[model samples]
Target chain A: LGPVMIVDTPGMDDEGELGLLRIEKCKEVMAKVDIAILVVDGTLGMSDGDRMLKKMFEERNLPYITVYNKLDLVQQRIGKGRTREVPQDSIWVSASDKINITDLKDMVAHLVVDPSNGRKIIADLISEGDIVVLVTPIDEAAPKGRLILPQQQTLRDILDTGAIGVVTQVPQIPEVLASLAKTPALVVTDSQAFKEVNELVPEDILLTSFSMLFARYKGDLGEAILSANYLDKLEDGAKILISEGCTHHRQCNDIGTVKLPKMIEKTTGKNFHFEWSSGDSFPDDLSTFDLVVHCGGCMLNPREMMHRIRICQNAGVPITNYGVIMAKMQGILPRVSAPLLGKK
Target chain B: LGPVMIVDTPGMDDEGELGLLRIEKCKEVMAKVDIAILVVDGTLGMSDGDRMLKKMFEERNLPYITVYNKLDLVQQRIGKGRTREVPQDSIWVSASDKINITDLKDMVAHLVVDPSNGRKIIADLISEGDIVVLVTPIDEAAPKGRLILPQQQTLRDILDTGAIGVVTQVPQIPEVLASLAKTPALVVTDSQAFKEVNELVPEDILLTSFSMLFARYKGDLGEAILSANYLDKLEDGAKILISEGCTHHRQCNDIGTVKLPKMIEKTTGKNFHFEWSSGDSFPDDLSTFDLVVHCGGCMLNPREMMHRIRICQNAGVPITNYGVIMAKMQGILPRVSAPLLGKK
Candidate 1:
């Protein structure tokens, strides 16, 4: 299966207190998994437990595959004649003998629709042989050896599209552009150095940040832009929730905790009560907060990022990401977002 | 912290049988963690339990940082005069007040040496503007929308080195070569299509598979090559262990369980007793097995892959990977391995 997680749960048919707890756990797991594998005993045929599980799956609109195990015993007892009564989509397998296991796997794999259906991080923005310069500052917070995941992925996407990628630090951007045979098609920089890079790169060249590119690629760009602009309307005592997708240690210059908060307060010139959240636990109730400023969400899938946006939409709260907010604060939101918004 | 895993252990001073089990569990966790943080109550100072934990860490050559928390309480009691006795590396902090937390994080990050250390997947092999044709066969096992990780990573590496990457399917290899302005520096393909690719690609062009490139990048290529040769020497009933780095469901045409086993039996004309292992569990005692065939280990880090190789070396059992073995059985081992062996 492609990017599928198969969780094995306890049998639904059980009695007593412990059994009920196990059943509750199974139901909880059912909400997380995309599909279900209902294993039945071929010798005994369909039971009430199987019927109940099937009904639950149907009610939830969860696609599933029914598998009748112990095919060896079934063959030994009924000589393959009774198997005709089994459902059309059901597969008969012997766990020990490895019979029809491949068929069962194929069924599971077929159920998965491609999630990354022709989505590109930046490849779609440029053509083959087009020069795309990336400005990455080697700051104290930068990883020791290689570039960060967003930069690496952007470079890879550009390469996949047959576009030329030129990487340089903030200081070398002017020289890199001067030395190029022709003016580069686009320039991308780290969000933290966006102000300096915006000043360095010429007005003719389209420019954006890694975070901005990912915001458009992974989530709703139009909504994020609207939320970024909403920063100006916040009062002095507004409640802001700062969220990150991954839970790494707080670095000395952590963007979510330190830089972004300082910048937001400075831009609005207002004191705001800030709350921090990281990792998988996003608060379901967003109504308590006046605004939610989230990370670029490189670690999260598009579905999750969209879900967070939808949650904010449902709660009537403004939600923006780190890159979009930084661009907004730097007074170049339109210039930085123009390339991604199809205004270039 | 750079790639650090911090585990909060239960206090070691608990009483009775449950306390002893908790202490044992802490010891087990200590073995897995790279460094330890011994948090001590600032008021109570060092206790016997703390000393015992320190001794255990020292015995295991595990580096540790001792933090005396509740700086406010310590200041109230001693007014910072008694802090001279604390180690130079240790810091006083108040978790609630968020004091000196950044210094503590900086200390942990300093402890980690850069792991990558300028390692390149294929960048070192090619120069700027060097054309590299990649032969990718779109098959049933291929992911729906995007290329697999290895291919994506290799293409990124080539781009990072300023090389031009031309991607084509197996049938288009000839046409891609014909249309190229110059002969490509290297031609890489999926290992499953090696036989056809070998015939289609010119002898002068450096050729290899994604799996073969990863074998060298992540593990010792010489060891893998030797182990692959040992496959021919196996007796009919020799015990062989087939291992995969990831534990995904077996696809109908899975390379590990289906293709490799079939090829191995056909080439060697032997019916060996095969055992399968996947994910993190590697058998400690490999002396019983005559040979171990492993996957390319793209899912695992370089350290873990090398550790597995060392385990095989210690047990005096030959170990090889899927790509190397497949090359050997196809009688193109020398041709494929040469590209990565520095012979080209």
Candidate 2:
């Protein structure tokens, strides 16, 4: 259990091949999760896909709850029985109606390592009143009126951590840190801005990306960071697949298109070939790829990312996402993720 | 050859379950029809799916010219003997760029029934100067800026048949027909407006919906009509899936949401049950369902629709779409589709 819980879920019915890619993702999330919640549209009765997932849970021996989302669309907690294969404890929850939410909280709470047991990485990190600073860049793709779901979620989780989370814009981060009375417990920066943020943050402060937690949560932190190190080895003319879970025009600063390639070349001193695909177009035949670097997957579920991660692993191709690689390159990989390992 | 062209198609990559249904549909189309054109997306490059369709053509000895689409999106065609698998004489086309359209015309003209032959269906039905009255009801689901694709296509086919097609709104159909010389050669209508239009067309005059052409073009008239009759047998509380190809709401008559179920029950003389889903959701499991009703598939490619059709057929479930069933109920089946079929 860490102070942050990053999710990587894709939508049910996407435009193209991306929709199917999301299915691979669900499996990834289940494989690494200590506690898993399978969510369904509340208004729509449980679908066959949901049933299929619960059976997967039974096979994997992962504990799970069936969360009925968008309760605001429908009020009833329409229930169904667990498959003969799964545990009888399958639950129904609604995030929009706030119905059965307490049940979800209790399920997650139970998954948390006991306080006396001192098993949670997140729980251990909080020295009551510790101020953790979150650095977020306000890019145009960050929705027109509000923060993206992941950022809002991070804010809520910070509140749950019982620590003062001083949210600061990336530019204000330096001033915010200098004015603080105490050395901050942590500084989490976006993967796109990590290189600069790492230079400014002191050696003692923990730094990581939301993507890093997801890599750990989905069970591949060590391998992903190692794969990311390949950024240093990208030879000129090497093909790089910069994949994103969602779509956006003008992805500010060209993180996938321009910056990552520059960083790869700067760090490894290798000229690299780059092509970008956003929203569900990772080719199945990946034998031709030299390296694949992905986003933090704020829009995707852990299950899908892990599937892609596994794809690379199965193909003998190196695959890594933004944050884990950034953290590893900066030399704070363990200090950032070790907090969430829960004795394992 | 009349305007009709029955086609057999291949399956989608992940839609393995749809194979049997598509094969059945292909067989149904093969059993009828005067001509067939196998359309292929050229820019994307033909793969196994196209190969499978080619095998079907070979097995049936059906004469077909590959209408390669989206030529505008590709670089120069690699030229003859490149793939070795594809026909050397295949015509390149671009629906988007309107390139090589005459090649398609020449191909269809050569491969299809001899249009000059007195044995052709359209020639036998309407002389060069004959008038054809078309009934099309415009509604919200009707594309705001243009005519629906099928109706526009049917009108073009009618023109190519050398008959003057007088188009009219459904309510204005009676007035327009009254003013025409004698009875019009044919009467075509939107199936949703079948009831009112059926009453207006004389018993001897030809009448059909835009959907009927799709049914015959895809080659499954009898089975489609028969499967749709399953709606009559559904229990009051029975589950029926009314699926559509697109995500947008029906613009007029609230057809899928309100009208179709009512007509199903009205014709069944019983309170038949109905449920609806639009956009990529075609149920995989059908053991719980009594029947499946699909739309005419204005938005889906043959590859995807045939997959859904196959799922129902393989599961031993009856399946039919809007136009075929409406044609049967209105008793105008043979006449509307006569344009596509030549004498044996």
| Fraction of the reference Cα-Cα interface contacts (below 8 Å) that each candidate reproduces | 0.02, 0.00
Q: What is the TM-score of chain B in candidate 2?
A: 0.60
State model 2's lDDT.
0.62
Each model's iRMS: 8.0, 32.2
Give the 10-residue window scoring lowest on summed lDDT in candidate 1 chain A: A138-147
DockQ of each: 0.08, 0.01
Candidate 2 lDDT, A1-344, residue by residue in tens: 22335465765555468867887887655544555677777566577767777688788766667766665455333333221222346555556546667776877777644321322223245544455666666554554324444444443344344444444455555655555556666766666676677777876777766666556644366777678766666667898878877775456326777766676677666677777777766666677888877777665545556667877788878888767665666666665565444524
Per-residue lDDT value at A155 in model 2:
39
> After superposition on all CA atoms, how large is the RMSD of candidate 1?
9.4
Best by lDDT: 1
Residues A76-115, candidate 1, lDDT per residue (tens digit)?
A: 8778534536677788899988988998889887765543
- Superposed model 2: Cα runs more than 4 Å off: A1-124, A234-236, A249-253, A326-344, B1-344
